[model samples]
Target chain A: MVIYGVALLSFCMLVGVFLGDLLGELIGVQANVGGVGIAMLLLILLSNLTSQRFSLAPMTESGIHFWSAMYIPIVVAMAARQNVVAAVSSGWMAIIAGVAAVAASFLLIPVLSKAGRGRPE
Target chain B: MSGDVLARVLTENSLIAAFVVVGALVMVSYWLSARLTRGHIHGSAVAIALGLLLAYAGGVATGGSKGLADIGVFAGIGIMGGAMFRDFAIVATAFGAELEALKKAGLVGALSVVIGVVLSFVVGALVALAFGYTDAVSVSTIGAGAATYIVGPVTGTALGASSEVVALSIAAGLTKSVLVMIGTPLVAGRIGLDNPHSAMIYGGLMGTTSGVAGGLAATDPKLVPYGAMTATFYTGVGCLLAPSVLYLVVRAVL
Candidate 1:
């Protein structure tokens, strides 16, 4: 069952990476574009569309959920690959830029929520 | 001879070794989050902080480019942390976001994605300009990173930015993610972030899924799915816009 989730994710990855590469080519870029994003969308589309039809077993579904929660470890692994020391040693430019962007975005939340206030679900 | 054989075996199965190391690291981070921060700072944020420090230590120790992955037993981290698994994990996160829940996010939830991406990009770009990173490619790549760590590298790669610039972009994105994680709970009360609607808006604006998810988990567990769903959308929006539209905007400014 767990393997099944991996199998499904593998299919999505192949198709998504291909599409992303094609998108890059279409846009004249030399790199893969939106590959992960495309893969994720495909996973969402496939799982939602198929769950009703498949009625997968409870254990199987949990296996899928378990993988979904794998976000933390995988993210840590991704972060581990980065050269943090060098990036920091270069300058404070990146640090300040990132902080400024987040601060501005955080401050905008109050204003943005105003648009949602009237349309409660 | 036995010790040498064991060492060889561990190196041969480096990915397995990486799992062991990372698993322990995550456990310690969670323990720290629970005990040290009293859950105000989520374990995910703590894990990321520890991971970055370890990467730094590894880099300094080996003077290697791949960070911790450069060491013999840790070499598997190179593949474990590569784009394939990163994307796999990211894609899987949206699996539980049933379409019905998505529809409930509504217009403001949708608007947040676009606004968040562009606003973050512009702020990052302005900082880049101010700090002497004036070129369109550098500015936009860093700007895209400010949107999210994922977006930063994607835009940098698409624009063919140098590896150092890409690294810087990623560093910037990581900082944003950590900040959002730590800051969300502290600001939740003042900003009225108790409901699903606002969580979605918050996610869109913040644009780091893990950060938003962790923060919301600390503030209110029920809102995690809503906020995470839209934060995921923000990354998608950022990936698309930062490399193309935002890059052009930066070019015009330059």
Candidate 2:
């Protein structure tokens, strides 16, 4: 039951995201990715609420299993793309970009900290 | 060549191979993560890995160049899938929790998170307009959840544009890095010794939404710069991290 629950949730969320994307395209209103995110989030909330109202055990955490396992095949394939990655010569750019970004993140963290400072009370 | 091997793999028995390979990898990651993290592994990672595998298999079988572009595209789309998948999980899990009377009130609790996502998008969109960047939907997902999956691929797509995707992705990475760096501090300020991480998370969510909203809103076609900046800032940190992330994978091959 737990396993099925998690699977059901995942499937629903996937459908929601896909649907949201399609909706955005069809409506031409441009809700952005948040539409899908919000949709899935709402679905999860709804599913959990409905299940509880009926008294069911929480869904299994199998999606985590499914998610973690995906990397192996990707890494393996990327391993196969070594030569293409090598020829790019853009490695330096990536490095520079990475360093700069990291540095920016470091700087931004404190600024955000300062900016976010407040208590509703 | 690897491509030839993939071709053979596909021609001989592609569907079976894909199933077996993906299933095995999923199990392996599950086992490893469960064993190491004690079942704490994230579903997003698994989804990403699956997306990459599927993309690669499809690309290779179809004779697409096994180049950065193909892989990057795979990664971008995978990120999109992964992000949505996680959102689904979060919502589902929350719902499951509510159903079983595990914790938190049902609708109200769920609404809190939904509200967060919406507010994040509004802020992200405004910020993008102020900064000047592209108005792609991928940018909208930045702050939503597990946007890393979308960020890389978005950058890949940006490369195909006249603006250059790598640069854009790298820019996105930089933005994330900045968000993370400043996010900690920013949240600290607002929450007042509360969970600083949450603030950063919210910021990221907002940043990405801002990008997407801004991008779509910038239909004039001249607001590309604003859209790009908005998009990059939202996913900047993730994009910047792409090189090293990909480098590590490439390094393993060597």
Candidate 3:
């Protein structure tokens, strides 16, 4: 079940990454350009448009949907590789100040969420 | 062959070894997620925390700039954790969402994105002022960094902030991203972030695309799109504000 789902995701990823890289090279950013977003669009297309043609099992469909949505292991990989030390060594003040700033933003989530409630237009 | 030869072999074929190392870490993280936190916390959160801890420690131990990726055996981490893979994972989330569901976010969702940008910027500016970055460029660059890493550079370039300051801003943004990723699931239940509306708000407020998506993924795979969609808006708003209106405000303040 997951195999087919992964195949679909992987197919999207390869094409997305390639196009993103090409776009980046064209734009001179030396990085992938909107590959993830492009791949996401492709995935949404396939998941929605081709579902009828494929007739995948419900578990397979959900499995594709599940990993498509979150997939935290990759997040961990990205987070783990960040150069926190380099950032820290640049300025202890920056790290401390940045933490305080982000913490404040975190605290404000509830206020914003509440302020936004009880209205539908 | 001896252990030396075995070590050399592993070092030479480091990509597979890196995957092995990461697989082991994820495996352990999930087990701890189940055993220690009883799955109240997702393995991704635990794994990210452990990753930060390990990377910080490893960076200090070797005094290397790239953290764990500096090690030969762990070198493939640069590829595994780099932007390409990160974006790849992020894009896949598109599959989970329905366009029609966006209607549910409504006006409040739009307001959240706008407010979330200013909210993060103001907090970052205040903190920057509190610290020793008394100059407008330094203060605003760091402040913009708090909005998101991308905004930091965009603002810095527009303001002509020194590259060192821009680097610091990037660092600041990276820190925020990690914080959001780890913090989301821990506070999701208490904050009533289970549904798509709240998820959109959370994404707007957090405004770091990767962090929001990752956190929401761990919390609820279905909610990733809502959070990421607004978080994308938040980035756009941050980019627009931090360089122009926000920069002028900082100049006036400092």
Choose the strongest candidate by DockQ.
Answer: 1
Error of 3 at B90 (Å): 2.1
lDDT for model 1 comes to 0.75
In model 1, what is the error at residue A44, expressed in angstroms?
A: 3.9
Per-residue lDDT of model 3, residues B102-169, tens digit only: 56665667787677777777877777777667898888888888888888887888789999889888
Which candidate model has the greater TM-score, 1 or 2? Answer: 1
Which digits, one per residue and each the tens of the lDDT, describe model 1 over residues B90-115? Answer: 56666666565556665788799899
Ranked candidates (lDDT, high to low): 1, 3, 2
All models, DockQ values?
0.49, 0.16, 0.42
TM-score of model 1 vs. true structure: 0.77
What does DockQ come to for candidate 2? 0.16
- What ranges in model 3 sit over 4 Å off? A1-42, A51-70, A87-92, A115-117
Candidate 3: residue A94 lDDT (0-100):
58
DockQ, Cα level, model 1: 0.49
Off by over 4 Å in 1: A27-38, A50-54, A117-121, B1-3, B38-40, B106-110, B132-145, B148-203, B206-254
Kindly list the per-residue Cα lDDT of model 1 for residues A17-121, writing each as its tens digit: 788778766765545554655676677788877777876566666666776666667667656766666556656887887779878987888888876676654
Docking class of 2: incorrect
Quote the true-contact fraction of every model.
0.62, 0.09, 0.55
Q: Could you tell me which residue pairs clash in candidate 3? A: none
